[model samples]
Target chain A: GESVGLHLPTLSVQEGDNSIINCAYSNSASDYFIWYKQESGKGPQFIIDIRSNMDKRQGQRVTVLLNKTVKHLSLQIAATQPGDSAVYFCAENTGSWGKLQFGAGTQVVVTP
Target chain B: EPEVTQTPSHQVTQMGQEVILRCVPISNHLYFYWYRQILGQKVEFLVSFYNNEISEKSEIFDDQFSVERPDGSNFTLKIRSTKLEDSAMYFCASTRTGVNYGYTFGSGTRLTVV
Candidate 1:
């Protein structure tokens, strides 16, 4: 079975510092990947995404790096802030299947 | 900006009872989906709908579960007989196109089966 997993379940960083969250996916057929931020009481919000053909994509203060060869993905947040504290999930879309598979999620905390 | 919206933020039902979770996806979006997350677990995909029909679904979406776009704006998921194991947060999402495009997800409905 195909699975997407994170390297860390929780990560803590200081405000103004950079934060990195890593994810590994096992499905080679996955063509698209997305990063979502979820607050305690809200649904997941899309942050950034990358296609298999591209190695990286950047959003406001977020960047997503994809290594198709290693089947790895990472989300980098520049100048982390308290508002950036949330559970982040990486999702992969296997082209063969239309459904998007989500990882268990990584909890990110930013302290001042 | 327009976003997905779900009704009945919370639901509680006894075992063997039926429950329907409703969602209203963004008007311009063409794809609709349902996903669930058990307490402390990963979010799992249940089903995807497009063009008034089901395009894909996961094994978790078994015979007990069914999805329908009964009206122009409403997408509903009905569980024939709820069970304890069915308790989870159900999220509804919509995308302008397919999987290549990111989706907009609703706040989700918490279903509790007692």
Candidate 2:
């Protein structure tokens, strides 16, 4: 079955340090990828998205990298803060459809 | 700042009972969808509605599940007969025209079946 998965279930980072979270998806035909942040008991908040044609996209302090060759995706957070601690999810969209298939969340814990 | 709003933040229902999760999607948004997150699990897509009809749905959206944009702004998901496994957090989301527009999700309605 086609699915997306995270390489790490939890990542610990010191405040002000850079953080990188990785995800690998099985669907090679997917055209768009998005990264989302979900606080406890809250819905997913969109962070940044990258199209397949673009290898990287930046927003605010977040950057999304897509490696189509390996079907891998990564999100980089600069100056990680305690407020940035939340479960992060990566999702893929196919053929201009908004039906998002989400990967298991990666829990990010930042300590000051 | 527009938002998708869901009602009954939490609902406790008995097994075999019917439950309805309601949402008010962002006005002017054309696509509406329902997704569910079981405890400690990834979010799963259920169905997508456009132009008052279902454009797509997942296998998880079986005969027991249905969606409707009964009125102008309200969209709803109904579970005909709830089961224990049906207990999960239901999230409603919507996006304007293009697929580039990622969905904006509502907080969610946590359904507990006993």
Residue A8 in model 2: lDDT: 33
TM-score for chain A as predicted in candidate 2: 0.91
User: TM-score for the second chain in candidate 2?
Assistant: 0.97
User: How much does each candidate deviate at the interface, measured as C-alpha RMSD after superposition?
Assistant: 3.8, 3.5
Highest-DockQ candidate: 1
Residue-wise C-alpha lDDT for candidate 2, range A6-110, written one tens digit per residue: 343899999999999999876899988999999989999999999899999999999999999999999999999999999999989853548888888899999
Model 2 lDDT, residue B67, Cα: 95
Task: In angstroms, give how far residue A111 of model 1 lies from its true place.
Answer: 1.2
DockQ of predictions, in order shown: 0.57, 0.53
Task: Report how far residue A69 has shifted in candidate 2, in Å.
Answer: 0.2
Candidate 1 lDDT, tens digit per residue, B6-108? Answer: 9899999999999999999999888999999887677899999989988889889999999999989999999999999999999999988786664889999
Q: In model 1, what is the error at residue A59, expressed in angstroms?
A: 1.6
TM-score for each candidate, following the candidate numbering: 0.94, 0.96
Highest TM-score scorer: 2
